[model samples]
Target: MRQVIPLGTVTMTYPGPVREQPLAIELHNTLYAADGEPLDGLADERGLRAWLGAVRGRLPAQARGADPRRLADVRRLRDAVREVLHAATEQRPPRPSAVRAVNDASRRCPSSPQLGAARGGGMRAAIDHHGADATDIALGAFAVDAIDLVTGARRGALGRCGAPGCVLMFLRDHPRRAWCSPACGNRARQARHYRRTHP
Candidate 1:
């Protein structure tokens, strides 16, 4: 027989989108969370590799044979991206170090667009890269997206989930949308209802 796990008892896996947002934003959200509970997705090299494997197309290659130092670097980059996003959401200037971190990562693995011949004799658009490894390529993509997110017009759409104890950020795709996901929305509404009925 299968054993059932009780709610709030199991250590949940990553709890956010995989490809819904830019890869950089997704990386920033790897902090699995609930009110007063935050779980780090990149807790170790194994965990980082697992996440990278799950999001196959996001990275040019798998982060195989990652060591503790490499995993720490990835986490550091993620924190920098999160800092930039937070500043953008608040309409404040991003920290100079955060900007530098993203720029540095982007420089490590720059992707250039090129026109290559297709199988049927037509030219197709493709991205060419420099001497970048899997981590560099992935971090470079995130850096590019984070730059756009902070400087582009869509910066106004940056939002943090209003649900109590939940710390997720997202782009507000439409008006009247508040929480990062439907589950968070329901939780917020239920909390409000409970407060009203109890009072």
Candidate 2:
């Protein structure tokens, strides 16, 4: 028997666990939407600052000067990541320009490996970055993660939400997982039901 469910109000902002996503993927998803009524999370300096604050220790340091140019750069990187993810989902190579963008950002603020002694006498591999500002470090980290995601085996799990007018992407860990979130799944089902009944 098919269970009937009610559709709740759709919020203007994305409601998902940000921490659960890889930092680069999270950055790519910063823009809450992609269709006609998209929501920009980093629309201004204040928004950028808020996003940086939320990421906190995951990034190198607090951004010193919040400006439009910085926000633009971040948005550019995010777009490049999106491009790469989109290509990966389509099983095709990403654009050379997009690859270059991610590579350039990563090179500008490369992360160094640090060997540290563990509590019981083992060695631990830690990441140490140099000579880059907070924003650059953040971009580099995102680029590195993006490269890993698009190039690694997990790339096969990449999927875009099937819900109508939705442009969200996600890693499909389960065989039956088609939507990016439960809400999107519900919305898709509701749409299917409406079309069936109306037709």
Query: How do the predictions measure up, each by TM-score?
Result: 0.83, 0.81
What TM value does model 2 have?
0.81
Per-residue lDDT of model 2, residues 9-122, tens digit only:
421322322535677767866766544467776777655655655555466543333233588888889889989988988888889999999999889886678899998999
Give the number of the best model, judged by TM-score: 1
Q: Scored by CA lDDT, what does every candidate get?
A: 0.73, 0.72
lDDT of 2 at 114: 84
Candidate 1 lDDT over residue span 101-198, tens digit each: 99998898867788989998998997776677767777777788888888888778888889888777888899677998888899999999999999
Q: What would you estimate as the lDDT of candidate 2?
A: 0.72
RMSD of each: 5.8, 7.6
